[model samples]
Target: MNKVSKELKTGVLLVNLGTPDSPSVPDVRKYLREFLWDERVLDIPAVPRWLLVNAIIAPFRSPKSAKVYRELWTENGSPLKIYGLANERDLQTKLGDQYIVKLAMRYQNPSIQSKLDEFQTSGIKDLIVIPLFPHYASASTGSVYQKVMEIVSKWLVIPEIKIVNNFYDYPKFIAGFAANARKHMENFDYEHFLFSYHGIPERQITKGDCHNVCKFGTCCDNITEKNQHCYRAQCFETTRLLVKELGLKEGTYTTSFQSRLGKTPWIKPYSDDVIKEFGKKGIKSVLAFSPAFVSDCLETTIEVGDEYKELFEEYGGEKWDLVESLNDSENWVNLLEELVLENSHQK
Candidate 1:
């Protein structure tokens, strides 16, 4: 059989959690209005979710978030958007002419709907989506997948679409993270390391437990068919892989969750609390890693780098450093190319 023409084009859409177009309160409010309204995010009845977001969360939270975002913003705009665009450009170049690469924000400008429209007109025969999140969570990767399908379902002639649900265990992905963290450790002789991931509500987790096996205990200690898709399990497994690769002592490194919202319980051993405890225990310096995000954004840049560092220092701890994310780096772009090529070859 003759090989498919290089011009037959496979479309690649790289999606990220998104950012406000600007750091102003109004822009931040607009961004939060769209992000928190998603059922996958807040995960409540429509009426209550609307009230919580519009009446309370957006009104109160946006101003504070906007300030932090302003600190993270650059001349080019949001770090998330900037890195995302760079990755798109580099991946397109690396993948060569046969592939059409586009980047989309899950909640803001350059939306999935618009990108899918572009792909439809381009006459592509196949589409591959890689959500920038390393782990699979209902609020992140799952929501992106749901949104993309919603947009494409109406098309009369849909392309062969494949979505990458999770790449937490991908060697290159893990290596990229380890490489970033090592760079930081090499500069500072930190006493401890923390792998802090974005937190999700516990209820959201139980809903994904098909076999009713997620008790938030040893059940998640090992990944299995029962909880293969469990968010917490994947997080633990990711930490484990990184721990081994970095040769971290068993007790010296810990896994914690960050960026929690609301009064309701989230994943336990919260990152803030962990840091505070380390402070009280007189642990001086520590290196923090946010593996949940592939790009440098508000969470890793401000939340972990600034807010948490201050909190730790207030409690008498000395240095707290946040390892930079894998945004647009050569290693990360190479991983994206490999991911696209591997997914495209799958039957």
Candidate 2:
């Protein structure tokens, strides 16, 4: 890689997790195959991962997932893709013609391979890769980073690549969430608040340097140099920031994890359990926040808003309202602009 010249155009790639092309079994199956087959995602050997994802999970899960996708679809299309594409287009206009801003899903259509293919010959000497995940996780951000490098490395001459990591602590990022949540919290009469982040396998946590510092108890309460990259710790840090930013008391909000798969235990305080307990404890009227997701997709829109809401209501809770993600919000667009300008010119 050579040093970038001042006049060189910068290519900004904003990568989201992804959604199926349509709410169809075949399309959903295809999406699942590409998503779960990743080594970073499935985290199993080649043959087993292939057999499990391709032969079993994808084939069976697609039908059920397609139904959920159908429920999640809007008049425009998949909300994740819609919001992501809008971010890309608007961000390009905000950045003007000086930079080429494009959006891609890590999994299905608009795949990273095809997107990087454009930048491969776009005459851009500098490139910025921002995985849209707020926190650093092997399955999410790490997978995006690996896939990007794998493709870009093959280019005859690679651009001066700069892949930005987690923005968990970015002020504007937190402010965006806080601003969105405040609109819902204006009433501020709810008995409790829940911060439900996407869960990862607990083994994935101890699998990395986090084993040195993370006990997944009090260790996650504070972010340290050793455990900084720990997904669990970063999740807690996000919760801490939101609590302070929103002026909520310590005991008022609880942090939990959702969307766990398989039988093995995931990061603790599972969201279902927490919601059930909130009802069992007779706590009603709760506000839920999913900071793990920046856009309203299946996880946020259906899972958190609908399914979880039903669970809470069934368990005796009166209300379970979810705070929307920062989907194409002005605050988020501002943050994206800062990310591009601040890193694109680095020494």
- Writing each residue's lDDT as its tens digit, candidate 1 over 1-347 gives 13665448889999998888899999999999999999999999999999999999999999898988888889989888989999999999988888899999999888998999999999998999999889899999999999999989999999899999898999998899999888987787889989899999999998888899988878878799989999999999999999999999878888999988888889877999998899778899889899999998888888899989999899898888888899988889999988899889423
Stretches of candidate 1 exceeding 4 Å from the true structure:
1-5, 345-347
Instruction: Give the Å error, residue 177, model 2.
Output: 1.0
Candidate 2 stretches with Cα past 4 Å from truth are: 1-7
Under the 3 Å rule for N, CA and C atoms, how many clashes does model 2 have?
0
Report lDDT (Cα) of residue 139, candidate 1: 96
> Could you tell me how far off, in angstroms, the CA of residue 91 lies in candidate 2 after the best superposition?
0.8
